[model samples]
Target: MSTIDAQTDSDATDVASRSNYELIIEPRKGLQLFDWKELVAYRDLFRFLIWRQIKVRYAQSAIGIGWAIIQPLFSMLVFTIIFGNLAKVDSDGAPYALFSLAALLPWTYFSNAITDGVQSLVSEANMLRKIYFPRLMLPLSAVAAKLVDFGIAAVMMVVMMIVFQYPPSIQIVALPLAIIVMLITASGVSVWLTALAVQYRDIKHGMNFLVQLLMYASPVVYAASIIPEKYRLLYAINPMVGVIESFRAAILGTTSIPWDLLGVGFLSGTILLITGLAFFRSKEKIFADVA
Candidate 1:
């Protein structure tokens, strides 16, 4: 009987060891990262979120999508007055209104994405508590939905170029890359803002101020050529500098590629994108509860 009992105990211990080895070990809290596969699994939800955001934005608005054109047109007039006439800001020899409008197109998309994306989770807290989907989807959808507005603004840019009798330069080929940088930057900022906004409601109030400050700091009204060569590289760290400058370079045929601007913008955009995604994923688990 002792021999049989010993053999049975050895068998039980072996089974337990096997079970332990088979069990999947998940990381502890705060170490979690984005799960791309899970997001892919919920792809339909992502589409629905994008559609929902679009519908919500335009449903009751009187001007509807027309606001996209009007916003840039009004901004162009203001910039033409303040920057062109009052401040005597140079537009690289192009019309001040056209130059400002070209820059404003991408900038508007980015600004709106940050503003709307930050509030997305808080605004949809009820849906969050009731259902389980990738929380990142909220901000991502908000940014994507705004692309329609960007498209409209882009169309307006083309029209303005034609109206000004501006012909496309060979460098126009680079415009796609420029727009990609804008998207990445916008999404990156959205990630950070969304994560931070969840915990600090103060972000809601300060976000507008920060964006306005950023706009002035960017070369939106003035030409990038006006900045001193020594400071240009440092200034390019603001990704918008590269974007606005490059757009002008492409459309107006005035400046070069702004390689220095491109370098800083690309590096900063990449770093922000990585860090922002990590930050968003780290806190996503608690978003439903706190938002």
Candidate 2:
């Protein structure tokens, strides 16, 4: 056989023997919505990013995960003194420490998630440039990493509840739902802030102040009952309001479930998630270029 024919036959045999695997790349046109299928296909990358975030979070830190418990625990103490004692803030009949800690758990998670998620892209700029993967994974992993901290801090909250003699009640059944709401809310805000942070670095600088304001705006140190009845619905528009209130009710066993407020929070959080996903996906194409 001719050398050229033999080479052609060899190439054909190699192609036929290889397993069928194909990847296509195309220039995206217009706004790209969230593609769960693509995200699922890249699940390994997502898991790796999450693991990297968790490792980086505790790396070189002497105390490591202990920082998680310390942050909210100390914040709860200061709030207990200033708001619980000095200002005489009401806690809906629950002990001030327990009340504040309940709210702080979700708040700390939300705030850290946003703060880290916002910087996830910028911080991983080298990876962003070196390889191609779902840009959403960076921010999503950042938010997910906070769950570890949240879990650690939660143990302290349980210990605090025991110290305060607060027992979980039927409302505790809704704790998972409340936590989902918080995650959705935090993920929405994180994606939005992360997309923006890619273009404007100033977003990172303003985050601390923004988080502080949001905490005060939320029911962290004070009870939702303190808000007048008329403005209660308006207050519920803030997603954290319902989340924090629900946590207090579930963990501290204080008030009954606030279905109306929770509904409002769900609605607002849904809107944020949709809009934030749209914005993030829209900006995703340019991330490598910008980052």
Candidate 3:
């Protein structure tokens, strides 16, 4: 056996035998179990991990942070031409460009976070095999880093709002809640995907295509109003529908709060968050060995 394995086995046995002679410790399923306190103990590493992700994200790109602005800007232009001009998509009385950009702001953040976060653990397998900080930090750091991009994109949205002469509503105060909804949705999916990713490497590429398809399916270019009233609830199951629509309502002052859709999103997002955290904790123990 390897030196580390020998030492670990010895220590585990010694501790168990000392605790109770009559009792036997058995292996548990679900891989690494969740340790809420342990994650908190490594808070410093969490902070550094978040910072490192940010730097690594923008370090060498010629456009640097400008990619954030360009992304939504380009999306808005394309959406305007195709959906606004060609399809004559209804935009709830707001200019199609402004309407689409508001939604794209949050949609971009959610898509990027999971798209990158799912690969965080697998890509850093070498580090995982060596270091002992909480494995959860890797996914969390990936999600956190995407917030920088979200912030830059948000600024661009505000600039466009002004240029387009769209005024904000009193609902603007709820903007942070909309952002939080998108973050929770992204992080929850990240936790599940990151854990499974270590076991299945093909998921990394598959997720990229899946996320792209999801963007077009979402309300990035069109308004929720286009959906017939009968199917609105069914459509909102995407979770992102509510998040994007709510963000647009707050900024553009046109789309009213889609409470029914928001309710579905909030429920789905919360469930996903809990499920992801539980699954991540369960499989954490295998990460160091597998990675």
Candidate 4:
């Protein structure tokens, strides 16, 4: 081979070596889209994020996990006294405490999930600015971590059921559906608010009032049957109305599973979730900047 040709070949090899190790960091092209597959691929990171939240939740607490049962348990007591006794609200023939608790358990989960999930990104601004993971994980994991609280509270529920002699009926088979509805609804609202929260901080302040209004709007303290039949269908559109009522039927067997409510709630939840995901994806590009 000619000397010049040999020299040129070495130069080409050197350039090829440099090219092999090069990494081009550039902006993502065009409009961003939610990558569902990327989320699945990062499942380990998601689990870790959930665990990290769980640790942070109980790290400095004295009662620790007991705090989970406290809220619903106390709420049940208050509602039992106010609605069950004072106003004489009907509990579908179920004991008022059991009646209120069944609703409180799922309701508490939904409320806490939204409260935590909405503020998750803002609370973790440093992490948001420093790293690249699925931004959805922040809200998603915040929701998941609350499952720990839900589980602890559920055990307390089993004890209450035993004391009250309220064995869940065969309709308990439908309880999973109620849980799914709760998750879908909470996640949807949280994602939408978390996305918007990165832009507008006012949501956090109004959230508690909104949650209280939602609780009362549903049959949490009263009977769904008491609502004029004409408005029941529209009332079920609130998402919690169906799930809260379903929790009662599935657990207390006070009434047949309200398939209509489930159908309505599930449909509304799906729309909220799909639209929320779209909004989150569109605004994702600005999260690090705003957060």
**TM, every model:** 0.88, 0.92, 0.86, 0.91
Give me the runs in candidate 4 sitting further than 4 Å from their true place: 1-16, 19-33
lDDT (tens digit, per residue) of candidate 2 on 47-114:
99899889988999999888998999899999999989999988888888888898999999999999
| RMSD to native, candidate 1 | 6.6
Instruction: Determine the backbone clash count of candidate 4.
Output: 0
* Best-to-worst ranking by lDDT: 4, 2, 1, 3
Q: Once superposed on the true structure, which residue ranges of model 3 sit more than 4 Å away at CA?
A: 1-33
Model 2 residue 144 CA deviation in Å: 0.7
Per-residue lDDT tens digits for candidate 3, residues 1-291, read 999999999999999989876766565565444567888898888889889888887899898999888888998899899999999988888898888888888888888899889989988989988867878889989999888998899888878878977778888888777777788889898999999888888788799788888887788887778789999988888889899899888887785777788888878888888899888877887987776
lDDT of each: 0.87, 0.90, 0.85, 0.91
Candidate 4 C-alpha RMSD relative to the actual structure = 3.3
Better of 3 and 4 by TM-score: 4
Clashing pairs for predicted structure model 2, backbone only: none
lDDT of candidate 4 over 13-97, digit per residue (tens):
9999998996778766675546778899999999999999899888999998888989999999999999899999998899999
Candidate 2 Cα errors over 4 Å, as ranges: 2-24, 28-32
In candidate 4, how many Å is residue 229 off?
A: 1.2
Superposed by TM-score, candidate 3 places the C-alpha of residue 220 at a distance from the truth, in angstroms, of: 1.2
